[model samples]
Target: MKINWKLKLGSRKFWALIAGVATSILAAGGAGDDTTLKVTGIIGAVGSCVVYMLAEAYTDAGNSGGSESKDSAAE
Candidate 1:
């Protein structure tokens, strides 16, 4: 199967997920003792979920070829 690697790399959701993973790793690697790093990691993970949801919503809306009015309303 052909994978759309470009699409994945271009996605904000993908970047968010990467950031989340990086932060989580940092937190686990001795940085977790620091409250700020722990908090940052948690926030990064939550932000990734939010970004993924938003990205999926936009992708679905675009694919459905919905009305511009609906899109404008969302904005």
Candidate 2:
């Protein structure tokens, strides 16, 4: 069986992982207060949504025979 790591970026699990990492970074930075945690959660949610949208757009473009590259979009 072969695994494609790139495809995982479009998964909710990957987004949740990103959110978890963001939460950990915030805690480590001494911003573990309730308000800060809420703000971090909001930011993580927004970030994940943006990533998902971009991934969807990329997939759509590819399916349409467009030559859009993820690297270029990231920049």
Candidate 3:
């Protein structure tokens, strides 16, 4: 199957958003008090869930054979 770079890139953005949110949560937690910890943890959990959901959606959208690129590029 031919790979669709555009769709793959869109999926990458969703993952990137998740990472950015997680990073922000971590930074907030490190500098925060108890309330901050709760908020940040919640944010991180929500962000992680969003990432997982997006990954599922992306996978359901179809593989597009990007898995081959991912495997070969590492070799």
Q: Which regions of candidate 2 fall more than 4 Å away from where they truly are?
A: 1-32, 66-75
* Candidate that beats the other on lDDT, 1 or 3, i.e. the better one: 1
Candidate 1's residue-wise lDDT over 1-75, tens digit each? 898764675566667667667777776675645664666667676666766776787799787776776788899
TM-score for each model: 0.42, 0.46, 0.43
lDDT of each: 0.69, 0.73, 0.64
lDDT per residue as tens, model 2, 25-57: 878888857856797678677767767787888
Give the C-alpha miss distance for residue 57 in model 1, angstroms.
0.2
Best by lDDT: 2
Error of 2 at 18 (Å): 11
lDDT for model 3, please. Answer: 0.64
Each candidate: RMSD: 8.0, 9.5, 10.9
- Could you tell me the TM-score of candidate 1? 0.42
On TM-score, the leading prediction is: 2
Count of clashing residue pairs in every prediction = 0, 0, 0
